[model samples]
Target: MKREEFLKRGLGSLGLFAVIPALTACLKDEVNASTNTTTSTVTSDPTTTPSSCSVTNSETEGPFPTKSPADYVIQNIVSDRKGTPLTVKIYIRNVNDSCAIIKDAIVDIWHCDAAGLYSEYGGTGMQSVNLTSVHFLRGRQSTDANGMAAWTSIYPGWYSGRAPHIHVHVYNSAGKSLLVTQIAFPEDVSKTVYAQGVYASHGQADTSNAKDNVFGDGVTNEMSTVTGNTTDGYVLTHTIFVKG
Candidate 1:
């Protein structure tokens, strides 16, 4: 199928069946860092609780080994509404092992500017916007001793067809990619944006996953998390799993 048709059908349905194995091979080059280990924890919010949807099986094991944290690059730094620079932490792990620790994983992240325009891809609708050669909103970060990596970037803006989101690529110690996913915002932002007719056609922005063809695929809520406040842009937090 053509590239446009494939994207239109969504990444999950694309016939890149053979590409999955090749993608996993690219994550073998991540560098592992040794620091004070931190325990993994989950937070609960009564207002934004996730529904009973399983995007990816948290039980699958990964295909690569772990490395050091110093070998990766951390990027996309920005300031919050309080003027405090808040760096987002990202983690690379094995797709199968829920708790398998892998260090030195390389992560490449990119997203639209504050005005909802991507840097490289064309035909996103905003043609007048000068998105070319502007890579300010993109960067790479590696995991630390605690299997956590962070980035400094501004909150992404909302577009007409989609809700606010960030794109992520997770690689292993050998620079092999393990997973490809997008992080979404909390329901609070969705409610406001949807009410304003931003994503109304998608059936209420707050409940986009159920309607968004891309998000409806193998992607899961556990793959990412949205946090911070929307009044001052937003802060999205997600962790990638790597195997050893």
Candidate 2:
């Protein structure tokens, strides 16, 4: 998902950097970053090769995948859920086609709330919370011409065995499944967000990304670039590279 060259050359050529921040601002209650700090680029880790256009890592969608995805095709997934505000911005690119933007791609995302509870499934031997009737923190969006799908959600809380993560399932324009993956948050950012508001009650995640089964290999492509803080909320920008 290398985009440094494209952001500098492609976006700069079309003068899109000036408008990307504005587009991110249109989400209203999603983020509160100043114009100077609101960027729509992937701030890759220096330890990884940022220039490599490789496919994003695929992970399990976890135990609670949406049973009816069509019913939750909206942007704001915060429906009654509470936590530190978080805006997730995902960009889809085609690795088979020279890392070109993949438009009209349907992207679905779901995660746990501040209390480490997922909607639609619980009350069982596995979860034991009884949230089968509610549907929060789950929704879908189609990618725009710029290959971006944004969502207004809250920062996810961690459970015992897994680190805080967002599950993503991508489909093509015709509704063919392309990839099922997960997005990992930066540990420092998660620690900062968890230390505030309702999240503080649950304490930090028991597992680190390096020890988690899904991310134990590496998170070079799955890690998100998170900005902002507990007061103003956080903004996570990540890129998913698929064949399309």
lDDT of 1 by residue, 113-177 (tens): 44455553444355456544434445555566656667766545555555556666665545455
Task: Give all candidates' CA lDDT scores.
Answer: 0.43, 0.76
- Report the lDDT tens digits of candidate 2 across residue range 74-190: 778887776777888888888888778788788889999888999999988768999999988887777888788999888899999898899999977766688999999888877
- Which residues of candidate 1, in runs, are more than 4 Å off? 1-74, 77-86, 95-98, 121-126, 190-207, 217-219, 230-235, 242-244
TM-score of each: 0.55, 0.81
Q: Counting only residues 3 or more apart in sequence or on different chains, how many pairs clash (N, Cα, C under 3 Å) in candidate 1? A: 49
Measured by TM-score, the strongest candidate is 2
Off by over 4 Å in 2: 1-50
